[model samples]
Target: MMMMLNNEESEIVKDEKSPCEKPIKLIELSEKPRVYRIPNFLSDEECTHLIESSKNKLRPCNEISSGVHRSGWGLFMKEGEEDHPITQNVFKKMKSFVNLTDSCEVMQVIRYNPGEETSSHFDYFNPLTTNGSMKIGLYGQRVCTILMYLCDVEEGGETSFPEVGVKVKPIKGDAVLFYNCKPNGDVDPLSLHQGDPVIKGTKWIAIKLINQKQQPSNNNNKEGSCAP
Candidate 1:
């Protein structure tokens, strides 16, 4: 059965005033899964800062599941690091682009070396899988994702939706936002995507995943919720 959005979930998409200093523009990439390309989402300095901070902290990324293949390195910020200036600044800009409430999951900086790529996958939880079910039981569903490109890839490294034939090239300081679930909270299969192999230069991206419910870590007297 498809779950419907409750008042709290509906509030997440309300058109609130942007918290940006500069004008914000959204370039539509796809409609079925509601994908958009945001240019200059991050400044050059912010991108450089994130890359620098993550350089010494990267570790091989974990696979989504036992058999799934995911290639890349990841640097996940510790809990309190959200107060760090670089991340705080990016989070502020992200709000201007998406009407997000409740604290977000920690940002993960990902690095893909030449020839590295993640096989196609869905960002939404697959309830049939044990890991997915466990995750959902704890954090609710991942309803949206905002990916920030920290550097340009000379040759490949495109975020591709094979089912839709949509490809977004990596451009420094740009961001791509996409919905993983419908307004009624059903997982959207059209949101399936992959990180194409980087052929020339490396690819660096920062990921922001928003869940349907607020996480326990951020439940400290915060007024808003992430739920339906």
Candidate 2:
């Protein structure tokens, strides 16, 4: 009877411990540029929560250089915004999913209405240009980027890589992860990408730029850069 009771207690303890949540599903979209798509990165409720929380914070995007053209509103989250419960949860999942270990820039949420889009641009800073070199010196090269789609659009708003002929539709809760640097730490030119115009409905997205090193003390660096 004593042995049977002990066995029953062990089974009860095992039943009480819940199973761990499953990781996000990753689909390889490219190899050379190291692009991937993560489906169900966020739940519908989580998507809505992020959209509602950041909608009012939107403003004109801060173009890193005059050569780049962007037609959209963006908001870079505050220093402690990551500590917010909603954003913190999302960040935790993203960090784990990508095996991200380096420091990251402040999160930026963007909104695009009909006819709005961003011209093709590279995520890494151009070492040749003065401004780009300065940014790189301060923040280091952007190693990777995680663009999370907060809502689905009715008509357009796909992220397109023209050279690779790859176009990813804006799907709520889906995320696109791409590497900006090669294995040898050199920036890749093939990382060029653009946000296609939204023809029908509005589009909402949140971008997290992962840097090669910890950001500097000054947090005034602008986002988005391109070659002339």
lDDT of 1 by residue, 115-198 (tens): 988788887777888977877776778788888899999999999988789899999999888898988888899998889999
At residue 138, candidate 2 shows an lDDT of: 77
For residue 85, what is the lDDT in candidate 2?
81
- Model 2 error, position 159 (Å): 0.2
How good is model 2 by TM-score? 0.82
TM-scores of all predicted structures? 0.83, 0.82
Stretches of candidate 1 off by over 4 Å are: 1-17, 63-67, 218-228
Compose the digit string of candidate 2's lDDT tens values, residues 104-220: 677778889999888998888888999879878877788888998999899999998877888889899998888888879899888899999999999999888887776544653
